[model samples]
Target: MATKTRVPQTIDAYLAGLEDPTVRKTLGALRTQLRKLLPKATESISYRMPTFKVDGDAVAGFAFFKNHCGYYPFSGSVVPALKSELDGYATSKSGVTFPPDQPLPAKLVKTLVQARLAEIAARGKKPAAAKRKAPVGRPATTGFRVGVVRTLPMTAPELWDWVTTRPERWLGPGATLKAEPGGQYEVPKRRGSPGVRGEVRVVKPGHRLRMTWQPDGWKKPATLQLTVMPKAKGASLHVHMEKLPDAEAREAMRERWSKVLARVA
Candidate 1:
């Protein structure tokens, strides 16, 4: 008869079972930091991982995998909300994964925890009028939209490859686009200039794409959409952007996308 293996039932037991010293030390430190940051949170093993719960809600958790370690906020929105800050890490809708040798930074961990707590607090409540105002230099959460469309001399596959392979052409120099939902992209700041960061929200290979777009220093992201369709002559490229701060921004992006489309054409 084969013997049954035991599973860890506590955080300490989980740590003790880790055979790799690097992973053990890294995750142990993370546990300590999580406890400190979430002093009021109840700690226990949930879903086979070490989890922290607040007010009967699981707010955070962590577990080790074959190639990486993961940090879960237990909220689908938290990871996406902080996509700009999480450029170098691998993220899914539910968790962020990092190398076992590199623990998540304390500042980043704190920010993640705060975002989760704020989300929990905001539930079942309405915001005051004052709280509805956009952060400085940001557009209101609703209103102000612009779009531009152009027909190009290429097939849908050719256009998709052109755009996805060389996203920096439109996204800015040094930009990267993963071209899949929940995948992240960023154009790093350089020489005192601002850069862009965001995550893909939708993707329909060779057909359509939608993403959140936010430049450096913006408090919230705006939405950007791109669509490709087969045309009688060639293919059509449509660019739509929303959540502009004012008429000036609307016109600016309108011109920008128009120029980009012209270049593509």
Candidate 2:
């Protein structure tokens, strides 16, 4: 059955009605920051989501979901300009998706709004490129790079728990998963360098998990997928990481993933 989308009469009610405590906290932080950042902007519920309007025009809006959350720039062009700062999250021309509990950084949000406002401010004397016809859809910027397979003597459920709970188990105390799409899948940093800080892209329990993997000094954000296929006896673990920058990077990932996959034994 399709889940019903409740159109909250107000943004407060929408945030209040959120069943997930983590989501409530995340949205609360975002709401507070948005209000502070755009004090002059009026708040209203639009299209069944929280929208902030300025000068009688909608500049931005945000919505929540079970696995992830996204923000609207009120325009497609705004996102592309701020892509570099939006690392570790999935983004589209229209908006950006961050982990449900990992609301966007206040600075990034400010930048996004600033970019949109600038774009709006320059509406006159349009550039020649702006005058030309644009493409139908956004190009796919995310891609695959390396994959490694391993047959584990563990059930799918066990494998799921093992991988998702790795940070807490391996990193030590005070560690826990953000537990939502776009949530943190951060590995502990090391040697004064960011070791393996990434974001969880997808989490299908006992079956599949995906995320972005940008090691400390990588040039681009690579993708990672961990799949658990239940076999008759145990299960097979397929670990794939992609979008590596070059052959050298691919080789490094192959070595890295190979070592990680070795743990499956």
Candidate 3:
């Protein structure tokens, strides 16, 4: 039988065992930069790595290991313009890593942090006439598109409370959810119509929510996911809808979620 892997319980313990002093120093600098750039961020150990939280939400973090130091932005994507600069390091969908001895690019890191903060701010703003430009190019495409709608009076805690404690308030009215994995969540209506349904495929609190949506009375279904994150100022919410069969479906779902998010502002 296989045994479960034991993980380090604290950031300090994880860092104290590092063999390289230079890596330690570099991570130290990175931590300092994080504090300066995101003053509200707090540090802790999560997933056996150093994690940072903002406004009581995990936003970004760093970890020093044997060969490299990892930097986690937690934001979905950094600004498009920074792609070239980020390429200098090892990057993934949610993070980057730099070699132990590589000189830390403090400014680039700062830029990335600011970009994430801006995204959080935009997410918190009200629906307005002029929209913030979508992240410059096609979002990394996926397999489906899901739409979410909610209306709650504007307040930070109110929005958080509704989303965390009373998800059913909005989702329940038009949809049905089961606690079991692979259970179906059916949305019974479209934006203006009635009697629509969908299926819930994924659910993780304060982390991810995914479901399949079919327009009321439509034959086809699309997938939707919402990823919730805490940022230095407030929260970072990302809506990814996929399996859209056409441009019109994609655009319509985007508009619907964007409008609902504006209400939280």
Candidate 4:
């Protein structure tokens, strides 16, 4: 007869059942941090993970996997808000993953919890939306910003080289990126007329890069940030460009980045 695996009914049982000592210790530390951050938050097994709830809302959760551990914020927007701080970890819209041996810092975990708390508090102040259904393929627009995220099959270092060396793949033909703070780059005029130019503002090789982007006709440059996050399988590339002129520009950039990601994938 086959034996059934016991489900953990409590956080303690979940930690106790973990076979890997590193995973156990890592999750144990994470639990301690969450408890300290949310002293009054209730704990339980929610969605098969150790969850922390505040005011009946699932604010945080943690789980161990075969090769990595995950910290779920239980909110779609939190991870993206903290993407800059989460350079070395794997992140989706809802969760961030770190190596079992290298747990997230206490400060970072506190920031995550605080962000969720603030989000919940803000939501409480706002009026609820109507019962009408929403449209599909709706673009997330905030001041004409465009953000795109894609998980690719390559590692962080591999992606860093692939993108930095092949600037034309996304930027344009005859484009260049020096990949250093204050380094200048340009995209030349190809078929018609105008070109684009900018300077790199920040660079963390194989992890993150930030720069300015201005076309020939634009008066002000937009800010562009690209982050490569490590994952259990490969890595995720996040392309965020802001200060676009309008929704049309935002949608166009979104589609452009989507195509870039698909090509890389």
Give the number of the best model, judged by TM-score: 4
| CA RMSD, predictions in order | 19.1, 19.0, 13.3, 13.4
lDDT of 4 by residue, 1-265 (tens): 9999777999999999999998999999899988866778899999899999987999999998789899999988778766667888889999999899999998788667756664554334223442123355663332466566666998888988887788887788888888788998899987864688999987777877778888888888877777776655787677877778877766667677779888879
Alpha carbon deviation, residue 219, candidate 2 (Å)? 34
Query: In candidate 3, what are the lDDT values of residues 98-129, reduced to their tens digit?
Result: 78888558777765665555445333332443
Model 1 accuracy (lDDT, Cα): 0.78
Higher TM-score: candidate 2 or 4? 4
Ranking by TM-score: 4, 1, 2, 3
Candidate 2 has a TM-score of 0.46
Worst 10 residues of 2 by lDDT: 117-126
- Residues 11-54, candidate 1: write the lDDT tens digits: 88999999999999999999999887777789899988999998
C-alpha TM-scores of all predictions: 0.48, 0.46, 0.45, 0.51
List per-prediction Cα lDDT, in the order shown: 0.78, 0.69, 0.60, 0.79
Worst 10 residues of 3 by lDDT: 144-153
Per-residue lDDT value at 149 in model 3:
30
Q: Count clashes in each candidate, considering only residues at least 3 apart in sequence or on different chains.
A: 0, 5, 14, 0
RMSD from true fold, candidate 2: 19.0
lDDT measured at residue 167 in model 4 versus the true structure, 0 to 100: 85
